[model samples]
Target: MSSITSFNDSLMSHQNFVLIGIPGMQEKNSWVAFPLFVLYALTLLGNITILYAIKIDPSLHEPMYFFLCMLACSDLGLCISTMPTMLGVYWFDSGEIPFNACISQMFFIHILQAIESGILVAMAFDRFIAIRGPLRYRSLLSNSVIAKIGIAILSRGLCVCFPFPFLIKRLPFCRSNVLSHSYCLHQDAMKLACADTRVNVLYGLIAVMCTVLLDALVILVSYILILKTVLSIASRKECLKALNTCVAHISAILIFYVPMIGITVVHRYGKHLPPIVHMLMANIFVTVPPLLNPIVYSVKTQQIRQRICSILHLKRTRG
Candidate 1:
């Protein structure tokens, strides 16, 4: 027990970590920085524009737009979580992160990712309610009710991710402190611990089972039911129109979950895969969704698309 206490004490005494910044790719961060910077810029501009459009246009005052706004906020949070540190590593090779800051990043990243999943589920639920229970949709998911659902979504993510950083804290990281990704992630940090990590592994697995995995399964089931409801429509045109309405949400879900699944797969069974592959996959998991989410909605969502076009046209007229 004394040895265990000393090990825990020693781990707590350490307060620094090094982000290895993508093994063989760190040498080319300058070249990498340009694309990353551009993606970060697009992520910021795109999501912010969505929020701004939703804010200014009263036509977008529906439940769908409201959820899209929430989604935009989550995407923005995700971008802010890792952009600076990622740029620092790419532009200046500044990969040293304080232990606490790393933990903070890990916490927010997981929380935001979880929140994003929850939002997608809510969006799916909205579509479900709209299609399956169109007559009662408003009464079932009114403004006040939507607010409560939002709170529950955020609360669930907080409850699930709250223990992630603390779980890592209990482990003694006597192994190398170099992280392979541009950002701090739970798996990245846990992998560096030399001690027995079975408990951490179990907790992490349970968290995933309850959160992302469960969310994905719920999303899948929602879509299946959505498809069934759409199929019941008498007119084929109506069915097409209904499915078309879901294209943006489906895209958002795919962009968010597919890369995440890839990251998990790479971590679990890609031992023989190149280190660069894992790093690139992790970076994509962070960057792609934020970059693509707003674009998908802007292009696919009619009200937001029209508002954006009007804004651009007005800008052109002024210019």
Candidate 2:
């Protein structure tokens, strides 16, 4: 307890923080940057292609594709948020970040995450409408309605995440200003504070519960209702077709949430585990969803697949 008080007494507002990249793999970071760069580039390419395809293809201008475009936009933002710090760490060995810049990065990262979760929930509702009431789907999700939904998603993300940086700013940091991951995360930044963080902790918990957890629950319920609708179809072939439409979305949800949950568990309870384990999970959580979502959609979504194929001039052979 005395030690804690001593640290608190010495606490001063730090102007800069150092990001130690890949705790034990400093020597191999230069080499590691190659694959990471490739993955980032591919993610950019995939998401851009999805957006472009939807933009040019008139047949793709529907509510489903609009939500997809929103998802791609969020994925692109997530990539941009993490790219500089991550690549800088591995490629140039530059990891020092100013306090305000760190706060900005942390804000964008969390807000984009919240936005993406909301997008998934929106997409699930789109699917539920499409399956549950195909006739009313178009009328229900009209252009104005979709626009309003998009606005609400953005507004909710902004409102929920805007307080995070301020919360961190009010706390004094006396502990070593080194973060666990290469990029700024709210939890990671909060852990270095020398003051009482109960408010921060409680607020963070409320934010996660309201956004991510609530969004996941909504998605799950949407799918369960969708499954009931699919099962009610009279023909096996029709049921299979309806279920297939959801495969890409289900894959996206799994990739995003599974890694997110894994990283959370590792951060909270995996102190005895290797530092490398934590590093890898953080990287995967941010990187994989953007990299794989487009791929999954391209393969599972037929119109998108054909549009992409035509754009690439790849001839599809009839089976």
Question: lDDT tens string, model 1, 39-112?
Answer: 99999999999998888988888899989989999999999999999999988899889988999999999999
Q: Which stretches of candidate 2 lie over 4 Å from their true place?
A: 1-13, 314-319
Candidate 1 off by > 4 Å: 1-14
TM-score of each: 0.94, 0.94
Alpha-carbon error at 303 in model 1, in Å?
1.3
Residue range 109-209, candidate 2, lDDT tens digits: 99999999999999999999999999999999999999999999999999999999999999888888888888999999999988899999999999999
Screening candidate 2 with a backbone cut-off below 3 angstroms (N, C-alpha, C), the clashing residue pairs are none
Error of model 1, residue 289, in angstroms: 0.4
lDDT of 2 at 165: 93
Candidate 2 lDDT score at position 278: 88
Instruction: Name the weakest run of 10 consecutive residues (lDDT summed) in model 2.
Output: 310-319
